[model samples]
Target: MGDTGLKRHGRDRRPGGNDVARLAGVSQKTVSRVFNNEPNVTTDTRERVLAAAQQLGYRPNGAARALLTGRTYRLGVVALGTSHFGPSSLLVALERAARSINYALSIANSFEDDPSGLAEAVDNLLAQGVDAIILSEPVDDGEEPLVVDVPVLTLGAAPVVHAPTVLSVRAAEGGDAAAAATRHLLDLGHRTVHHIAGPQRWWAARERLENWRHTLVAAGADVPEAAEGDWTAARGYEIGKVLARDPGVTAIFAANDEMAIGAIHALHEAGRPVPGEVSVVGFDDIPVAAHVWPPLTTVSSDNAELASVGLNYLVDYLNQPDSPPAPPPKHVHNLVIRDSTAHPPATEKGDTRA
Candidate 1:
């Protein structure tokens, strides 16, 4: 009988340990070490073994290898199903970074508002034997972390269920930025700045709302009741039309770029002159941010950088499981001032109430 203790499944023709040893001209144990990436093998031997395995089309079975090394070498990402730019971009960045570090990724997109779906996605990733899970969803204050056997990482400011967390930016910093934008409008002498906020459940949205509120309050400007949207251009447009009609809204800070674009369109449709009558600011300086009639002034989340750092942190964690918990991932945010924002026009100076 063949030396492989496992039988090949139908049409699942992948070369195994024995096959790797035969090609590498070494014992199966040696091939096993090489495949596991264990240390102490001579460099020359490791190179030869890797070349031979590559030539023979040997692919390590993650499940079987997990049995041997106690690590799946697979990372899991739990993402939100919405096509919002931040979550989608973060997932793509994580996948690319995972590949860069020689790890495989398995992802599941969960609906942000569905608790059961989130639990199911977590269970599925665990079932596949992932080493850890990175959650891109904003933490649900009402929910507990899905009880899992693996480490869980939450990527936003909200308190996730007892899991390690990272944030895109400090809520305070985002608040500060919004306040600064408000101050900018204030300096330009607008009566006040109105907000088009994102979904209430999102940590980023909550934080931005808080900051915007604080800034307007500090500036002695009447902060209007914010309208909520799901961070879609369509929703932004809808709210934009409402804000456009008010005429008292001298300035606006959209929670994200797509919404900002929609808001701009709504302003045009309502016959309000942008910047001249209503200055606009947005968040997440996505590529389209600049393409709007006036290039957008917004913030950058450095999402790709966030992904790279998270993957590198996980790798380090894997290598040293005994180490104390790692510090939370650092989130960088910067303001990009472009053509979109300018001093509010002279007409709306006295009317702060909206």
Candidate 2:
């Protein structure tokens, strides 16, 4: 066995490439080529490398691989630190998609309240040498966009950063989802559909708000004032209480399922049976959407598909800069119709189509 005696640390340290090479009776460069799939190593050599790795419980060093290949093969994600369903779901999807392509994800959490946290998060990811940065659950602080050096992809919001390589998931999808939800209620004979919206600072929240309003205007229905919440069941309950007091409010649309469930509790407490007196609709058909008292009729996002498509575009931009970008995936803002929504009760005027 030939050994170059290339050691990065002490003998007692966790096994690294050097140890794998020594134990497998192969050169360090051969191990690198095998791990990198350079296509020159023999099948016997590859099998020995794997056997040695399994025996030594060794894992490939990302830093070492980056040094050898000149690419970190890491995807960086900048996301809000909240557990809000929409943002959290997309984050999980991004992790899955990145792993599917043999790439790793590094994440930096930014607080929604701290507007400057965006810059700091980007800086942290940049120091990590990620091939691309994904801005997930972006917020609108009314500040100018940050200038970034690497490729940027936005999962929910449109691109908020100025970068050499730019990619975006369906920016119109949120608004389109909102339109679908609103139209569904109006079509069911509701004179007017009230809204319980998330904070306007979030791009996702704003998208739902603006689109809901637009939908109302287009349907020629009376547009009621949108009530804002913190995307929690508690906040939804509070807003729902206010809407329940109004007899004219026959239908309600909450931005996310948490808020929607909260609103349902409020209406029930106020003696208004769901879809009996007040039809309700929610967004982000979460796991518990069906289990709730009355199943929630809400807009469902294909989070996994959205993440995979965005990652493909980012990888494409990195691999083939000269080629035109691939066409973005077409997603339908499909609404899940459940028992929570129905035709409004017949008043003296009766059920009228919008």
Candidate 3:
């Protein structure tokens, strides 16, 4: 860790575990334990070991660790490459969760236009020798399901790909959330609710639309034709202009916060007072939802918990690749009611205020 060890290892040699162990006054095995993130090391010992390693400019030998563990400890993800809040949040959650267990993450992105992107991404992860592959943030991909040799885990949807070893831990998606949002509108005395749904190809999008429709049907409410959107505010605004033209549209459920915000803007421009006439609900409870002029009421799921649970399932699959797909982790959906939603406007029946 000091100039002595540096001189001993020679100028050309790299600092390794021994130097860190000597500097930290711990055994070589302890240094290995600390770097490998195994249990039995105290907090002080771990910090001392890390500090010593840092001072010596020592980095763990990735190749050596892989050889010793017989696993790369890497989880590769094929995620939808967009700035959409939901997907972006899930990606960040996955990174944080992976690091907590001392694992590495590799991500491949597939755009909506790239149908064959998933296949190529699977091959790329396989080539990288990842322990498992995760399919996150489903998109409208037309490519045939992929088949790979390693374990595969998919979040928020079905197994878009097939693998000999498949975990397929279902991540919580839209069904419950959509139903909650739709029911919230119905409970407010809106005879019928309109929907602004995300594109149908993605499983998450389809789930939200299907659930919203089912909820309306279950309530014996009028089911209006839904407007499909591209998960973009611009698209939401475009669709909103059309919906705003109809006086019959008393309540609206947008698939995401961005769309809801866009719809709100369009409604305002059209001289429509939100909640006074058209009550709006959105999904994903994004940060801006609360700050908007009329605080948006929306549904939220824990992306961080979803990501952590998905990785743990992947780990289980790695340990037992042949086990049947496990029951989905328990997920909770929260509906935050705010000023944006209220009872429908007074008619001959009676006026019901917020």
Candidate 4:
């Protein structure tokens, strides 16, 4: 007496390849060919086999299939594992892109800043037999380069990795965005712009900082020392206090929207009216950016589109390894103007005031 009042057999009876073959009126090998995506089978035959498998709720054994095909059909993602807008948004986009291509995603997070942490994370993904890897939000830790045997795709700047095939796709150039924001402020009559930068270890942060400095120098504006923030509102608030007190500081650009929001709070508390006495701008037009008081002026990029392009390149390379590699395309960043920035106040003066 089985639990369901059905007779138990020596061999467990679940949906299997032979069951699908019988339902589809095809041979078991034909069913295997369909599951493996092998060619030479007629289109009608493939359709019938798939329909039968669906009807019988039959799923191919992935482990057994991988053993036979020498490919796992799985993609691995290594991320910073933070709730920050950029990394989190890229992770979601990667998952969606992988699913759309019939590939499963194995995500691993590196919480520590050390290179060993990333190495360990990559090893974990490799152990799962991912066909390719996507490194998201890579940072420099001043350690030896990482080596991987499979194709590696980087979301932003390329990390030091010794792999046969390395591809990089950026959502938006951070340097360009920073330059645009800084120029916008200068055009609005701010003598110089104060910067609140993200951690220097991350490449994106360095790019933004470098461009901001370059833009000011090119325009012959006095480049003030940039304040560093740890990509958090709390850190932004702390740093913002210092800048808020400097009455000469007429314009500020925070690395990202969260920090910008924090700066605004600090300014309000210090009785400095945004866009009135002081102007503020930020990077990453996150969902809440437009809803914040005075509506944040920030740099916006299409993270999902970037993810799709990177994933498609990886898939294409995997499918056609012998094809000549195509040069990566350039991405443009857009600046969204809002209520947070304006010309300097009438009483404000440039180097003379500070």
TM-score of each: 0.76, 0.81, 0.83, 0.81
lDDT score of model 3? 0.83
Q: How well is each residue in 1-354 modelled by candidate 2, as lDDT tens digits?
A: 343344456554577887888889999988876665454689999989878877777778778778866889898899899988889988999899887655799999878899788888889999998888899887765668877898888766553578886777674544489888999999888878899999988888888898899999988999988999999999999999998898988999999999999999999999999989999999999999999989999999989888888887787666666778676655556799999999888874644532
Off by over 4 Å in 4: 1-61, 113-115, 171-175, 348-354
Point out the higher-scoring one by TM-score: 3 or 4.
Answer: 3
lDDT of 1 at 239: 95
How many clashes in each structure?
0, 0, 1, 0
Model 3 misplaced regions, further than 4 Å? 1-59, 169-175, 319-326, 348-354
Top TM-score: which candidate number? Answer: 3
**TM-score order of candidates, top first:** 3, 2, 4, 1
lDDT of 4 by residue, 66-150 (tens): 8977889898898886899998998998899777655789999977366566777789999999998899887775668888988
lDDT of 1 by residue, 169-228 (tens): 232333355666656667777777888898987777887788888888887879799998
lDDT of each: 0.74, 0.84, 0.83, 0.84
Better of 1 and 3 by lDDT: 3
TM-score of 3: 0.83
